[model samples]
Target chain A: MSDLKKLGVEVLSMSVDSIYTHKIWQEEELSKMVEGGFPFPMLSDAGGKVGQVYGVYDEDAGVENRGRFIIDPDGVIQAIEILTPSVGRNDAELFRQVQAFQLVRASKGKEATPAAWQPGEPTLKPGPDLVGKVWQVWKPK
Target chain B: MGEEELDLGCARPTGGPVGVQPDQVPPEREGKSIEEVRKPMVSVGKKAPDFEAPAFYEGKFKKIKLSDYLGKWVVLYFYIRDFTFV
Candidate 1:
């Protein structure tokens, strides 16, 4: 998230705990992260209302699942990655998707980014003509 | 492409458009582990559901709503607990 902040992206962390729990955790653990302190607001979804909205609430455990959502500027979900509790999220991959999505969005339906596309890397142009010749222009990285 | 592809604060992928009821998962499964949680209702390319929650920000607890942020990209992520065994 510290890296993403450089790209002008805002990060909001959520948990099913309360403000007090987050305060203590932020002070003792999150503040000691590799990037220094967690550079974002942490939301306390006390009643799991937002959690259920996010499909991350585990009704049985009364906790949440590890879910990541990338929302566009227009209030739409552009990407979704949900994982189990023991799995950690790939922060770098999240950054990649965010960059790719922004690039495609700026193209205004003219360009399509292929898998593992990085910034400044070539993106594909979607059209009937370019259908069968995908290998002709896009080289695998 | 999903709105999750965008960087805005929204729910993650599940299926076509995120307009389902929040608690579609039955409440009877509370004792199960996190791994058994039902699949998400929201997915890529869907309208993210708006919600309100108490967020700890700026040294205080504030009521933050998904609708509160408009015209900006948001990356909303949820973790199981605070200071847990990851």
Candidate 2:
């Protein structure tokens, strides 16, 4: 969250925990994080209304799944990643995506980030530049 | 050579009109600028998905809705676990 703050990215975290549980956790855990200095608003979605809209609610699991959606400033869904319960969200990858989105926005849609691509990294041009450039950057074992 | 052959010399690649650079046009003057066309995942364009429910904000039960941030950018992120080290 701080990394995103450094990049000027605003973030809101929502959870499926009930208000009672959220309050308890906030007082017990979040207060410590704050003293330790974790800065960001934690939202509660106890009814799972938000999760339903994003398709992250797991009825069987009785909790929201790990889902991340990068919405552009225009309100359009740019990127959506929903991970299974067993998996975890990658903060580094999310940071890279945020950077890539910023680059795409800065370029005014002339370019897009390729797979596993990072900011300031070479991007493909969707035609002749696709194969050669992609191969050059492809990490081989 | 035929007139067609003569015209071929002036033709640009992609068989479109020559001497017109699309980027040369001012973004605003163009019908759809890249900024105007590309929509962000969360804000400024489409109405954000409405979410109205009970939430503890500041103090007390408050109604939090997507409409609350009609004009502002809102990033709603969700995680499966809390207080767990990955």
Candidate 3:
């Protein structure tokens, strides 16, 4: 989405819908009601094939529940979030995580960011000296 | 609920159904229920199952696959419906 654009990340949406239906929604509804039509592709699992694979497809509800999977560059899943239909997703946290994941991967797993880690902030280096003394040196903002 | 709903951190969903839905989903989908469909859940640290389906892109419908994004960080998200309040 536009929020992820600054972080150099792209998104893909999947649902138990048809491609044609998505086209119409993106054009008539999403574009008119929202700021922009989805910048990324929206996959339609009409038959619930991929949905069944991810367990997001609700066979009983006749819809796909909210599910998010953040896969790394190497095709490894780094994070996962699933929510019910009533609740919406937190795009702010999702954007922050994308940055964190990228930073960790850039460090070749040598550095790990603590929770609520923001960009340009100091990342933790796993070692003995930082084990028990983390609180002593880490300056929480 | 209206005032509190406005305080939600997430963005409000816009638009209602446009007369047409995702395409008429077959009533008997492989004769499977939620329990049967979710029997095997995808776990982390495992290779994501690669599958292909029709995706809307550039104002056209085309087939897209998970493998197409093998080299980039992908955030694959799924939501309920485009129009519903959810």
A-chain TM-score per prediction? 0.93, 0.79, 0.91
Q: Using lDDT, give the best candidate's number.
A: 1
Predict model 2's lDDT versus the native. 0.58
Best by DockQ: 1
- Report the CAPRI category for model 1: acceptable
* Candidate 2 residue-wise lDDT at A4: 85
> Lowest lDDT 10-mer window, candidate 3 chain B?
B1-10
Residue ranges of candidate 2 with Cα displaced over 4 Å: A33-38, A125-141, B1-48, B53-64, B67-74, B81-86
- The runs of at least 3 residues in candidate 1 whose Cα sits more than 4 Å from the true structure, single-residue gaps closed, are A34-36, B1-41
Docking class of 3: acceptable
Q: DockQ score for model 1, please?
A: 0.37
Report, in order, each candidate's fnat.
0.79, 0.32, 0.74
Tens-digit lDDT string for candidate 2 (A1-141): 777877776565677765445556666787686663345445667645466556777767767777777766665666777777777777898889888887877778777777778777776555565656666755533
CAPRI-style grade of the A/B interface in model 2: incorrect
